[model samples]
Target: MLTTNDLMTIDPETVTADVPLREVVAVMNRANIRQVLVVDGKKLVGIVTDRDVRLAVNSPLTTEEPLQRLELLNGFKAKDCMTSNPRCVTPETPIHKVAELLSMYKFGALPVVKDDALVGIITVTDLLNQMALIPEPKS
Candidate 1:
């Protein structure tokens, strides 16, 4: 049975609450990742994703603004757009269980915690990778 720790991306890319959204996008682009954990000190506080940025950019309030203006304003800070109180999993959680939770809740990723400390993250991509590694069942 695979555990979350076995498939999770350890020391995953993270951003500080005060980091500008532009910087976050740059980091995500550089890392080729779609999601980033928002941290304060050493504690995981929230999560930010490309979807969040898209929502902010496409919001009615910002729709009429010029691209540059929108980017400048929307790119304020991670805390301004991050999803707080994000659902999390533990290192000991079974991979299948995490998959179930993610599917049931429509979550793309889940932070892994131990003693309330951030350890890693498991994303849908990670789960897909794990599934790919599994052998096919006999017919």
Candidate 2:
């Protein structure tokens, strides 16, 4: 069984909750990644996904109508809208199990943690790429 550590993207992108939405969006776009871990001193605190940013931009957090993209982006921070306490897996978690969790939850990615410290991340794309690399058994 392949462990998460074997397949997870190590040193995955992360951000502090206090970071502005603009910066977070910039990082996500630059990395071409959908998820970013929110950490405080190496401890996992929350997570922000590309979906979250999209939804944030669209959500009317206040009574203000027709909020412009610039207004929304400048008005919020990661902690104000990030998904708190997202489900995570460990380094020892199996690849199959990770796939199952993603399928079951429709999660874009799962943070990898060990001893409560954020370590890596595994995504559906990662799983697919890993599976594609497997060699077929011969008769």
Candidate 3:
């Protein structure tokens, strides 16, 4: 059975929980990724998605001034907007199970962990890439 280890992105982009949201946006832009794993050392702690950053910076009730928006972004840290203790899968977890969890939870990715330490991350794009490599069976 294909597992996360077979298709996961090793050393995926990560950020410390104390990282400022502005920096998170920069990382995402530089990496061209939709989400980033929040970690403390090697341990998985949370996740912050692009949507989270967008919402944080573009709240309708908040001021429209760019200066205020900048302040808001700088004031918020990853921990403030991140989903704490996000569900995770081990590297040995089957890809189908990961797919199921992603579908059920509507998650873009799931952190891959081993021995309580972050190892990698498996995203919807990862599964799709693997699927593309599979050969078609006889009709």
Top candidate on lDDT is 3
Model 3 residue-pair collision total: 0
lDDT minimum window of 10 residues, candidate 1:
65-74
Candidate 1, pairs of clashing residues: none
Note the Cα lDDT for every prediction shown: 0.88, 0.90, 0.94
**Decreasing lDDT order of the candidates:** 3, 2, 1
State every prediction's TM-score relative to the real structure. 0.90, 0.90, 0.93
lDDT of 2 by residue, 1-139 (tens): 7999988898988889999998899899999999888999899999999888888887765444545777788889999889999999999999889999999999989999999988899999988998789899988
At residue 2, give the lDDT of candidate 3: 93
Residue 96 of model 3 has an lDDT of: 91
TM match of model 3 to true structure: 0.93
Better of 1 and 3 by lDDT: 3
Tens digit of lDDT per residue, candidate 1, span 10-104? Answer: 99999899998888888889999989999886689999988997776667765565786457645679998899979999999998999999999
Error of 1 at 12 (Å): 0.6
lDDT of 2 at 109: 94
lDDT of 2 at 65: 55
Off by over 4 Å in 3: 136-139
Highest TM-score: give the candidate number.
3
